[model samples]
Target chain A: MGRIPWRLMFAHFRRNKLRAALTVGSVFMAVLIFGFLRTFIVGMETSLAECSANRIISASRLSLFAHMPKSLEPEITELAEGKAEITAFTWYGGIYIDSDPKHYWGRFGTHPESFKKVYGPDLILEEDAWQKWTDLRQGCIIGSDLANDENLKLGDRVHLTGNIFSGEVDLEVVGIYRSKVRSFDQKTLFFNWDYLNETSKAAGGRKDCVSTYCMLLKNAADSGPLSAKIDAAFENSPHRTMTQTERAFQAQFNSMWGNLPLFFGILGGVVLLACLMVTTNTMMLNARERIQETGVLKTLGFTKGTLLVLTLTESLLLCMFGGLLAMFIVQSVDGEILMFVIASVPPSTIWLGLGIATALGLVSGFFPARLVSRLEIVEALRRRA
Target chain B: MSDNALLRFQGVDKIYKRGDEELHVLAGLDMAVNAGEFLALMGPSGCGKSTILNLAGGLDTPDAGTVTFGGEDIGALSDAGRAGWRSRNVGFIFQAYNLIPVLTARQNVALPLLLTPLGSKARKEQAERALRIVGLGDRMEHYPNQLSGGQEQRVASARALATDPRLLLADEPTGDLDATSAKDILDLLQRLNRENGKTIVMVTHDPAAAERAHRTLKLDKGRLVHSTGAAH
Candidate 1:
């Protein structure tokens, strides 16, 4: 029932400065990658959390590329007993003039009136800007992020050279708004659906079609039944509908990204395995060098169990130090640079990193601790002599 | 065996195998050491002098017969049980003065006391007293690498004496020391046995180191062939 002297443990590490640092460094690198993967998973969860529980999106059953007829919008609105607000948006690809050809922002031709009611006050616009956006045929609303990136304000006209639709389109930005929901992706441009339909028909393209129909319920609990009813209404039609909650719709990107969280998780495991091997070798070397000291400890009445504990505790302390250090470093470095995605290492991820580090210690210390515990005193002393 | 014997070896057999050749180091050896007596064992290489001390300290078990300490067969105990008994009964000093290089002299001396249930502060105080008894009071903070040959041995002796065990076993404790350092170590061991009345079993090749003991037992091939300055 004797207590381990933590000072002795630290002394061993302190004496072998390089080996200790390398071991701690190995753990840090491994757990940092592990924590980074965990952060990505957390970021995905946080993004999903922004989706309103009451909102649903109805897309073409086969693919997002397949179009649904605009006639379904009126039918869905009539089916609702004053309980639903419906809107529709056609996907428009907008490439800004005088910008990088590789980069593009989403442009959508959405029903203006219903879009305002469905999306709520997160789409903030001045009264004049709102009126101009609704009144003018060529008027469009830009997200705050897009306006800031292009250095535009209300009434500032932007020229876009379209790639998907062959045209040089000039649209005046009548409003700039921000979305409270992160999954809504605030780098978008929205114009009136009638303007898009008339322009597309003039350009000899298909008319009366949109990519998706979005619905918002007054009571969030009506989502499941309303979704079923909406899907049933068009199930027999050529443009069959697939209705899902907004969160589930956004989750489709997980497949688009090839389930990056799983890939990152596997990468984290590989890094941890590599670190475990390196740290295990370092621990074995430390143990080998201390055979005489272990024999001395045994001769002084230290039991095999006690030696094992000391060895394990030494490694555990190293790993814990590395894990906490990585947490601190990641916290300091996150969101500082200009990146496409701002991934955050949450508090839970830090705790998880510590747990992983503890497991690393247990695994890495096992061989060395067992070797020391089972060493014969006569043989161990003879090793040095 | 005498009733007052602190340690007894009855018909002890020890063997070593080197590449399929069996070297019989000890053959049915019997020995007894009385309480509070300083007994030195001297022999040549591979003579089983250290093997006998190892058995007496419960560090090893004989192939035949029992090694008993304080009327109990220590060789009969389980590994864990023997470790517990050894902690309470025996303190060992090695020839190399094996102090953990990382720990200070005070910490090294306190190591044996750590096996007890005593608090850390009490262990430190007892360790300090042990170091002071060996006249290295001011060197408590020095590490083994920083201390001299004689100082390291004294720190080791302090460690052995710190727990106040009933028996002290030294296996060529002065083998690595210079003549002056060796004499100093021998004087410390003699003082511990005579002044402190501790029962000591020491294995040494040096006759001068053996002379410090109250009696000397000459061993040839693990058999006690002769003795001087004490009755067998």
Candidate 2:
């Protein structure tokens, strides 16, 4: 065996620039789609990983749309004492104060003290922000993203036209909170519960009706026993409830998308397989052109292993270039499109590009390397260039 | 011949099978070459001259009998064994010059030395020495595409001599060259045989090329029938 001539192998790729570029382009497209698909799944999971550990969501027995009676909040709080911290919130579905139709944010109505206790880790405060938030009666805490989008500062006043309550309410932005986790705190708008209860009572809507209660357990491990206790407490009540960890609660929202991860997985696989076929075809043509070169090397005393390694290295190198290109393109465009489509992109998607490129290298190179290794030196040399 | 015989072929045969049909190219061929001899093998096309060369160089195996080199039966060796032996003991010069297009003359010459256990520096030095022997010391850095056909053939000769092989096999080394380049290649082969004491087995159809050999053997249908010493 001879020393591997990497330069020699690389020269083959350099000579056919167009073919190499096309092969690499195919791989790039495949890996880019792979990255997109993977980012979607990770984005969904990240919403879970980023959810507040101190907050739990309690919903109906069958679905999130099932409501619970506001009377249960006291009993739930009594049972949660010492073992957990409890907060109650109802989805308000408030309309945006701005004229932009696309501007929508999650609005929740809750008791300020309990909400602060449950979300303390997630809150980002300005100077004297907590004092201002607790002192004002019409105070609201807005996500940093919402603040930026609507150009609202800490002292700014904003009005919401409630979709569910059907009235206009003015609230002062006393604080702006940003989540350390991805996209979690960026989309929520929090306001006082008294405003919501008063508006609903005046409108003769369901005043004692609440969508869910959020419980913060002392330990994450205690969630299983505590969830059972909460559910058992409401088992015979007029409106029975189901309590779950924040992760499972977020996952239930994912289930509404209906096997989306499996769909993306299948799409990623098909694109990669198509890319593999294109790569294999390109490599076969390249290998055919090098038949004479292979013979020359064999005649010069290069063994079968050397030829195989050289050919496969060439394929792998091409794929690596493609992978890098795909990563660059995905990193550049994914942020804007993801924020539009699914609200955020996850970092773990980078590995998807690398994995697809590696698999393409191996799968595409297999037949070409074997063909080069089995070529008869005499016959190969006799081949017309 | 007994004391100096570097290559010997005894009753060697090569048969190619295409489905049920058998094509016998070399039928029980017997030949021998001694050290320091320049032997020319001349024949018409399909006379099995190249087949004999392939057998002796360990590029192809004989179906029967034995092709031996320096007492080892090459026909009986495994593919890897044959490759190892060929790298250490045999150097080949093809009519096409066969220099790897991407590599410069120096790299092409150093190719055979790569099969040896020599380090990179040592391989370069040996390759330079071989190029100097072929009078192409200045052209070592030029790629095959940069050189003329004559220069490329000279580089091929340098590659053949790089590993200090005991036998040099040339298959129509002057076939693709002009008349002057062909003469220069023959002169190099003659010098390698006479001055360096390297065994040379060359196949050619040109009588002028054969005239440079110390002995000429004619093969007709795999049988060697006529031979003449250089003095004749």
Candidate 3:
């Protein structure tokens, strides 16, 4: 076997500068988009997986937006008896700074007393943060990251303009808490459910319902049976309940925006196809222009396999360089603002993208190399084009 | 033809297919060049002169007869085997001074040596020696684009000589050069043949180029119509 035509192929790129750069750029864009998309899915879903296995989330069977009566909380608690502690969990879509999306963070209305019992294991808080949240009626706890970003501290007043429901709301930042789990985003603002109810009632809107009931089981293994028992108790009521483990509930919550994973997968596929087309087109042009040179090498006794390996390797190296660089940027930079979940992409996801790069390189390299390698020497020499 | 001729073609036939057209390029071509002979093939375009070189160098197979080098049938070898045989026995020089544009003169000359078992140091020594023989030792590090037309051809000739093969094939070696450059290349060829006793088969249309050889065979259509040199 002959050696790889390393220097020759390297110089070919120098001969066609714009084409090579464009090809590499195309590969870089494809890899960057694909990596970010996979990271988004993995970061969000993996964090959801960290939610305690002992917790069960029960929502309206008809729709996530359907209101469930808060009066059934005690009945659910009774059904679980010693098995669980229960709380109300309601999403609050509020604009913190006018309507700019960049200032966005989560706002959830929950029963602060039971909220701690349900989520205590994952929370890291100041010594008196819990007491302050319970002692003050209009007090709320902000995530440590959110507090730091907004420069908010204890006793700091925060104003929110309601978007989903009517009327503005005001609350004091009573505590700054950080979460041990990323899926439970550290940039959320959690307040008492009773505070929201009293504010709405004073504004001539009586709040009688909660969005969902969260039950934290005493034993992790009892989550399934306890969830079923609670749901069965409310099966014949006016508003039916669908109860599931928190992880399953989070999956359903993600599906509320549509099949995000499949959408991103298809988007990534299209980008990759475009990358393949561009790179293959450039490689084919390179191969065609050098057909006579290939003939010259063949006459000098370079075997078909040697030429094929050399050509294929050149293409693969170019694409891999672009791909590996894109993933490196994905790692070095924070994408929390873009991903809206966790910022840091996992190393596993980077390795997976590299696998995609290798496959992309091979596929894009094969056809052009095969065409160049399979030509007869006499014919190739005649092909001056 | 002598039974011990270094390169022999016996009743060789070559046909080319172009879409629907069947072109007969060579028909029953019987030729022989004894060892140490300098032979030339002259003809118009499409007359199978280059085809004969391709078969002799094992770059292409004949449709009908045997092409043998030193009594071993090269056409009978597999693709890989023929490539190996060519690397071991034949060197090729092209009309366009076909040096790789990317490689320095030394690197281009070292290409065929890559097929040999010689270490890098040995290959480098052989390439430099071959370049020095062609009087381009000073330009060994220059790329083909950096060298003149005649100098590039010298580097190509050095590449052809780097492996020290027994047979050399030159197809229109001076077809693309000016008169001065052409003469210098022809002189180098004569010196290699005389000093190294290398068997050479060159294909060219110029009578002056053909005159440099010991024998000249002229082809019209696909058959040899004239032979200016004595038949072996």
lDDT of 3 by residue, B45-141 (tens): 9999999999999998999999888889998999989988988999999898888887789989998888898988998999999999999979989
Candidate 1 structure quality by residue, lDDT tens digits, A31-117: 887877776666677767877898889999989788888888888888776788999988877577755743467788897788888
Q: What 10-residue stretch in candidate 2 chain B is worst by lDDT?
A: B223-232
Best by TM-score: 3
Per-residue lDDT tens digits of candidate 2, residues A243-286? 88887888887788789889989988899989999999988887
**B123-163 per-residue lDDT for model 2 (tens digits):** 99999999988889899899888999999999999999999
Give the chain B TM-score for each candidate: 0.97, 0.96, 0.98
Cα lDDT for residue B34, candidate 1 = 94
Judge candidate 2 against the unseen true structure and give its global Cα lDDT, from 0 to 1: 0.82
TM-score of chain A, model 1? 0.70
Models 1 onward score TM values of 0.75, 0.77, 0.82
Q: By descending TM-score, how would the candidates be arranged?
A: 3, 2, 1
Question: i-RMS values of the candidates, in order?
Answer: 1.2, 1.5, 1.4
Clashing pairs in model 2, backbone N/Cα/C closer than 3 A = none
Which window of ten consecutive residues has the lowest lDDT sum in model 3 chain A? A332-341
List runs of model 2 lying over 4 Å from the truth: A16-25, A28-32, A46-114, A121-127, A134-249, A320-357, B230-232
